[model samples]
Target: MKEYKLSGWPELPASYQRTAYQRMLHQMSQGFVPLGQLLRVSGLGRDAVRRFLAYLQASGVLVEREHAQTPRTLLVMDWIRRTLGGTGPRRQA
Candidate 1:
């Protein structure tokens, strides 16, 4: 299975209105994520997340682990985890 991470936030097109995509954007923004976990975390089903992943890849924000050459990014991700207390997916009332 391939793993991926965001190089940076991708700009959403005007047509993107799915809340699932929004949730996914937040999750992917966190750190490196494997495709399986991305689907699991988003709770938005496999097909939808896969499509979104493709879009992000095309938009150049999605970086495959093979291309993620920065160790500093890992360090920053760790800092974010510690500081944010693992703020994973959630829902609001």
Candidate 2:
């Protein structure tokens, strides 16, 4: 089972104007996501997700993550924090 992560904002080709790809990229921008989830959330089939991922990789916009070692709870917490704009800790003088 291979996995990919969003290295950063993708420089999409102007010709590749697809909403499904856009949605997948948006979700990936949030954090690392499995290919399965990408397919489910993007509402795209397995082949579509796989092809899109390959395209992103070939474009050098996708980087590999160290597998899905991240705990589900942590992922949820991170999502919540992002949703509420709270990313833990604060620096002050």
Candidate 3:
């Protein structure tokens, strides 16, 4: 099988391209890194990350839960994760 490499980055929707979304995905994959650390890992501006997270919430891809005084984003990656059943139906617009 030919090994396929991505050309640049995936052209995600504007909602997904937000820094916050990027940071959230990165943290979910890499595990609980601090904001500063996430910034270093994501290579995006602080403000941009904030906006990305907002988009993720709006898209219903993530949910926020309050703990004490702070809110933490809960990953809903399972919506995309394959299950024991057959492949899920595509989302409708």
Candidate 4:
């Protein structure tokens, strides 16, 4: 993995963003994110997530994986909910 130097807090919410980034990182560490799943997890629109994902990829925070039938993001989501102390699994319906 490449090293990325994240600069200054800059009055932006670094802590808040970092939490989400860490969750994403944890997911990637466990497996990999399938295309389009970041939007749902990050609560960001598709365009924004596309840009964020690109930035993460470039920054070495994330990597793109080969396409697959089942998205590993589902497992990540469950892990996140568990980590956050949420009750029950998140429902897609």
Report how far off residue 31 is in candidate 1 (Å): 1.1
Among these predictions, the greatest lDDT belongs to 2
Instruction: Give each prediction's root-mean-square deviation over alpha carbons.
Output: 12.3, 10.2, 17.7, 12.3
Order the candidates by lDDT, highest first.
2, 1, 4, 3
Candidate 4 off by > 4 Å: 1-19, 70-93
Model 3: runs farther than 4 Å from truth?
1-11, 14-24, 29-33, 65-93
Q: Which candidate leads in TM-score?
A: 2
lDDT (0 to 1) per candidate: 0.75, 0.76, 0.48, 0.52
Q: Model 4, range 4-85, lDDT digits (tens) per residue?
A: 2223212223543665555544445556565455545566566665565556655554545455433677687677877798
Q: Model 4, 78: alpha-carbon shift in Å? A: 27
How do the residues 4-90 of candidate 3 rate in per-residue lDDT, one tens digit apiece?
A: 111222336855656655555756443333556545667878797566555544555443432222333222333444343446654
Itemize residue pairs with steric clashes in candidate 2.
none
Give candidate 2's TM-score.
Answer: 0.62
For model 1, the run of ten residues with the poorest summed lDDT: 83-92
Task: Candidate 2: list runs displaced more than 4 Å.
Answer: 69-93
Clashes of each: 0, 0, 2, 0
Residue 56's C-alpha lDDT in candidate 3?
Answer: 49
